[model samples]
Target: MAALYVLLAMILVVLLSPLLTPFNTSTQFSDAIALPPSWVESGNMNYLFGTDDLGRDMLSRLLIGGLYSLGLPILMVAVSSLIGMSIGALAGIDRTIKYQSLSRLFDTLLSIPSFLMALIIIAILGTGFNNVAFAITLSLIPQFIFVTRNAVHEEWHKDYVTASRLNGCSKAYLLYRVILPNVTPTLVMQLTVSLSVAIMDIAALSFLGLGIQAPTPEWGSMLARSLDEVYLSPWSMVLPGITLFITIMAINIVGDSLRRALKERVNS
Candidate 1:
């Protein structure tokens, strides 16, 4: 329950941050560069979180960066899940040559770690936002496909499925009316897996300088750029790191709680 509230608060803050930001994320304060958080002797009251090495306000940037860290992954998961569920479900329903080939290919791809897969794709596609987004989204799709395909395939062998087929139920009807409801929990569970991977992938790619570029207000890049300034201003690193930790933790707890609830409901 607490985790859910924290997640909601983070979402709300991310959504409303633009209006709440006190300074332009890019604006530099020449005189106020590298100050610590307010209350520190060297810190300025005007800059509550102080300024970064570039003199940009930390609080403003943190608020804005939450969007990229939290937002882009949501988009990535949506895209990957839609495409993956489609391909995976088709592969589950149709054991044809083409689908088999595609499924085998995904199996091979899944053997490679998602971050490594993203890196390999990025190597071919090059850096920058579009390429990184494409790379992460594509890397994540295989997991969805694998999970969804397995879930759907399991349903196909069930006694109920066989009975439905014997009753002359169409493939579409079986899929929508029978298979989907049974496998819905499994599919929804994969959502958390995809979301967690997406968040980590974006952060890692950005940290390595392959994801969202500088001045983009992304948590990962903020962490990367702030690394050297840690001694001078630890908040630069601590803020983003803590935020990432909290966000990921909240997601996992909520996802686990949801999975349990759905399983109980299905059993009941």
Candidate 2:
């Protein structure tokens, strides 16, 4: 519950961060360059978290960056889940040669680490927000495919599914209405894992200079930019690092809680 609240609050702050601050991400305040947090001796209350080397408000940038950090991954996971689950369900229900080939392909892709796969795709596509998003989303899809396919396949072979099918339930009905419910707990677990993967992948890409570009204030990019001024303004690095850690930790906790709840539900 606490993790859920944190996640929700983070989402709200990021989504409304633009309105929350008087400054835009790139807006520079020449007078306040490298100021410390307001609590610091020389700090100004006007900039709650202080300013970067470029005089950009750290709070504003961090808040805005969260949109890319968490928001984009949320979107990426959703897209991957939809496409992967559809293909996985079809493959689960039908043992056609084409589906078998696709399963092999999925396995092959999954064998390669997801970051490596995204790097290969990004290398081929070249770097940009669209390309990175595409690369990451594609990398994410196979895991969903593997999980959903196996889950559906396992459920399909179960007695309940056989009884449903024998009672004239259509394949579509069985896949959607019957198998889907039973497999949801597994899928939910996978969803949390996928979200963490998406977040790290995107951040790693940006940190490596292969994803979001400069002036965008992405958390990963912000951290990368802060490295140069680490000694001068340690808070710059600390702020984004802590934010990323907290966000990921919150997500993991929430995921764990949900899994425990679902497990208890099953046991009961």
Best-matching candidate per TM-score: 2
Q: On residues 61-112, what C-alpha lDDT tens digit does candidate 1 reach at each position?
A: 9999988888878888999999999899889989999998999899899899
Evaluated at residue 19, the lDDT of candidate 1 is 98
TM-score per model over all chains: 0.95, 0.97
Residue 11 miss distance in model 1 (angstroms): 1.8
lDDT (C-alpha) at residue 251 in model 1: 90
Candidate 2, 81-174: lDDT as tens digits: 9999888889999999999799879989999888999999999999999999999999989898899899999989999999998999999999
The parts of candidate 1 lying over 4 Å away from their true place are 39-41
